[model samples]
Target: MLEAARTTPTALWNDSSDLSELKQSIAFGGVGATCNPVIAYSTIKKHLDVWRPRIEAIAAANPTWGESQIGWQAVRDMSVEAAALLKPIFDEHNGRNGRLSVQTDPRFHRDAKALADQAVEFHGLADNIVVKIPATKVGIEAIEDATYRGVSINVTVSFSVPQAVQAGEAIERGLVRREAEGHDVSRMGPVVTLMVGRIDDWLKHVVARDKLFVDPSALEWAGVAAIKRAYEVFQARGLRSRVLSAAFRNVLQWSELIGGDLVVSPPFKWQEIINASGYDVVEKINEPVHEHYLEELNRIPDFRKLYEVDGMTIEEFEDFGPTRKTLRQFLEADADLDALVRDILIPAP
Candidate 1:
């Protein structure tokens, strides 16, 4: 699989905070992991026995910290532990793989300075950590500022070619700035995370509601098509930032993007399916966007504008279909975590 004609893709675990699961994933060929608010909340709830002592220690030290701060601290500790486990892989790959992502509070997604500050703090947790920043209008600026400050970043919530292109350009701009300041550009790491599955899910609902007809075959391939288009744009731009294909929903999405210079963070179920298939040969399935589907999608002006362009103004990128929805989801997750911490956990402060 590694010696095939196409690029050998790296596998990254999609969840964080389970040591046993993390070890299992690593043994099953995963080199990294991603941490999000929902995962963090789940970890806290399920592993209370494991995290209780640490949470108590944090509360004891802070004395007056609120639920939000304490919740994030727990998240930081779990992410750091995950990063420690992946550090050797990171070292071996020269900082390209073995990344453990720690996401910032989504409430701060619109604040560039706060996001940058949170990223810097997360970077301080471990050397193998990549701070996950939302691909919002201010997020691009935050990515640029964080990269310029020598921080590795994973620009999350990207759903279109324009968002991915803007993210890559932001990282490039930051690297250039860092180089001007005498920092080594080779050490900086940035990944633009293009979400699959969700695009198709959204389009499915839209088609169902509006009763606009399109080829069902083309609808099934919408997610993969979006990813392929994003990959093409990334290649044409010649940017240094890597592309991380995330939010996969099925086996076909996994098999189709087999050989690419991208990181795939498929959920545990999909990973199991791939492992059971015993697939050893790598095949390149980079098909062009389906014409009929593209035409159908173009009926929605926003979808067409974003799909056709490689780049867009920051305003357009923020208002793009999945970006807004994904950010709200993250914020809701953060809020849910806060509620859980306040209502259930009684850390002595």
Candidate 2:
């Protein structure tokens, strides 16, 4: 089994660019990569010379396939190449952390039925692929239904506790359904990506209340605390999904959660952080396990009730200004962001 500190290192890469550098980074330590249409469009636009032949070839046989078709095909091909690059680690770790995630276009974010259909199609293109879904109302519903059908999901763009909890229950409900049917539940690993930096970037107004100012230390600490509390709830409920810390804007956030199961970071930043340290530290945190949390979850009348609840979401919290403001509120809360910052970031020298 892979150690917790080694967890998984997934990064975002431009789909059409020379994956040579990206591949080299993966060889160094990156476990997987995440790509979207915007990334695909931008990457291909910038490096069409590198990607034209590949895209044209895919579009050749299926003459009917248009821009959308070609875009999604690129998504699959990039993910497959990334998975192949990490195959050694996958085989070595027995499939624990060497996994790549690819997101469906944001255009499908609210269309549950179409999103589920795309999930199935994407899974067929790559066996190691974990289909990424937005945490919208319909998207969460699609995640629950698709997981029940045996599709692994990565719930993306999550920003609040409520959103994270909903994602956990959706995966658990699927696992429970599968277990009851005597199906193999071993390959299932759902992930909820808590975008911390964006929150701090959004909630800047409250950074300084009447007489206090929020520091990067406080922002980093509060984000981890929120994610930790969510994981605690997941353990309590015996949920099978894992937490993936993502949208990390700095090295500090990644350092704080080095013990987390997986963190999909930006490609360039991850490389910088790993090299600056020049060495891996001894693991310090244990995987959280709580039997009572599981028992309480089992007693629930319907885990799906969370679907109806509305709270902060990536939708309502779009852009940096709002995230910065919300983050400041957490720092100002009674939640002890100071203590968390000290423990997670300021390691003993």
Candidate 3:
């Protein structure tokens, strides 16, 4: 399965600013990339000399623009460069591979119209660019609107099976609408990101604080189990949206889901570990969640909803574990980038 996956392309989850790293990832079977504010900010900071002129030019043209706006413009420029690097691969794969995702601002996560409009703007950055949308309630609506308008989207911040279902539905709805209007749906690309690691990270903290008697092994498998179950949901629904296995914590998390239709975006270090391990069999790791793990997870009211794909309302999906925390983290990173931009654009006189 690994070899077969090799024949196809995989995506890397990192900043696109580093040309050497991006090329290395492509050489190691990475066909695409994902970018966020953290990456955009870090890249700008690292290559101040390279980006300083661009920011200065923008500042001169829009003197009335604030620091945040100027800073985000730099990020947009970086995103365009990254997309250009992957354009050939995207063309070669005919839109399946060689796609780049740039996330919308977290502040508009709950505004569907804003997200859709922003998505269209990001799409204009490059042909290979896929606007990243958070899978919040409004975000799903935005996904539908963007898809309807022929914009590709990468749905992020999704943790639950129901959330995944909603995103898939939105994508499908948009595709159908496009099809009705005589637009081809073959080139449309959308991926629902199912975050791993963070789920177990949250569970571990809960177990320690609550002094729960849950088995340690069970905790270890929580993240993987949730992801596999979500994959099962995707498979069962036959949704067009692909599953992106993201935020991996270890090699097992990378190795476990090799044979499925999902695309795994392992971090740079984790990718190195997988390459070093030299494991080469693509087998299904989509086994049922361990009975003990499920039982223990059921003890927590919040986790119980996450453990199973059903029984959670749309409202519950937004308030569930990992969802709120992930959004908060994104917001914090956005603020950090905003501050970094402010300092760069308007230095202390």
Candidate 4:
């Protein structure tokens, strides 16, 4: 399944200042491009002197577009250009591979309908575009609704098994719904992104940074264990959601999760994975998304609804409070929460 994935690197790391270097990376093996508008906004803003003419041309041609429209237009244009550069691979793979990903603004991460709308709009901009979304409650809902319409989704920001499970189930549900409604399920192309390194970085506060290097085997093993569990959930559910590990900070985590059905790696990590040795297949455990999931799914509180403050918009994300809270409660009743959260939250990125 990993082999079938469109192994694209995040374009955020690409040298926008040097188109040649960016093009070279794309040409080498990147089948897709990933970007968040905020990141794009920042990057393009930094290079606006070099970008103004292009934006001006687009705005000049369109005329009615506003400043925000122009900015997003530039983003779409770059994404489309990057997608076009990868068009051959997209065409060669016959649409199963070589797609580009653009995330909806983080501001609306919890708004299902808004995300669904973005999926439709973004899909119109590029044929190979995969609308990136978080693996949150509403995000999953958005994924389902979008999938029903045949939009590709890359579920991102996942930090735990439950989140990963939600992504897989959402994919299967979307597939089932589409099939029921007489839409083609095969074309929807769903991918689940499991973040690895962010959890490690968070854990650095708890564990000595030097310990990560001192007992490299221990740190590495914990990450692999988390990924192995995630894969186990993927296989158990028998859902078609392609697992795409993200937030990769180094080559080792890439090695651990390379068995994922798909992987959206950062550029630095992409280079590491591309250059790493011993990419091998591993065993998958039998686990299914069960009725028990409905409990958590129902308990999946609306983070956005809870925190409506303009600045604290995304605080309502399940990962921010409910998910972590549940995990905390469980760990308190069980064993070491610190150890488990470190493994689960910071799997290996």
lDDT of each: 0.76, 0.56, 0.76, 0.55
Residue 241, model 1: Cα distance from true site in angstroms: 0.7
lDDT of 3 by residue, 1-349 (tens): 2353565333444435465667777776777777666667777778878877888888899989887788788788777877888889889978876888888998887788999999999888888888889878888889999999988888888876677788888899999999999998787778888777777788888888888877777776777777788788888888888878777776556667766776787766666666667677566556566688787777765566665767477777667767888888878877877776677667889
Regarding TM-score, does 1 or 3 come out ahead? 3
Which tens-of-lDDT digit does each residue in 1-349 have in candidate 1?
2222124654455556466677777877777788678778887888878777777787788978987898888888788888888889889878887788999888897799999998998888888889898877899999999999888999888777778888888999999999998888675567888777777777776677778767666666667776777777788878888787778776557667767777777766666666777777555557565688777676654455556544467787777667778878888888877776775555457
Taking all chains together, the TM-score of candidate 2 against the true structure is 0.72
Q: What's each prediction's clash count?
A: 0, 17, 1, 12
C-alpha positional error of residue 199 in candidate 1 after TM-score superposition, expressed in Å: 1.4
lDDT of 4 by residue, 21-54 (tens): 3466554455555554444555565565767677
Candidate 2 wrongly placed segments (more than 4 Å): 1-18, 205-217, 262-266, 279-349
Summarize candidate 2's per-residue lDDT along 1-349 as a digit string, tens digits: 1232344332222121236655755544665555544444555555656666776676676777555555556556766776676567556655454566767656565588888888877766655667777666677888887788878788876665567788778878877887789988686657776665554443333444323333334443444455665766766777778776666666555555555454545545455556566555433224332344333322221211221234345344333243334334422321232222233324568
Candidate 3 TM-score versus the reference: 0.91
- The reply for model 4, stretches above 4 Å from the true place, is 1-22, 58-66, 206-223, 268-349
Instruction: Rate residue 58 of model 2 by lDDT.
Output: 69
RMSD of 1: 2.9
Estimate the Cα RMSD of every predicted model relative to the unseen true structure: 2.9, 12.7, 2.3, 12.5
Give the TM-scores of the predictions, in the order they appear.
0.91, 0.72, 0.91, 0.68
Task: Report the alpha-carbon TM-score of model 1 versus the true structure.
Answer: 0.91
- After superposition, the stretches of candidate 1 with alpha carbons farther than 4 Å from their true spots are 1-17, 289-302, 310-312, 346-349
What TM-score does model 4 achieve against the real structure? 0.68
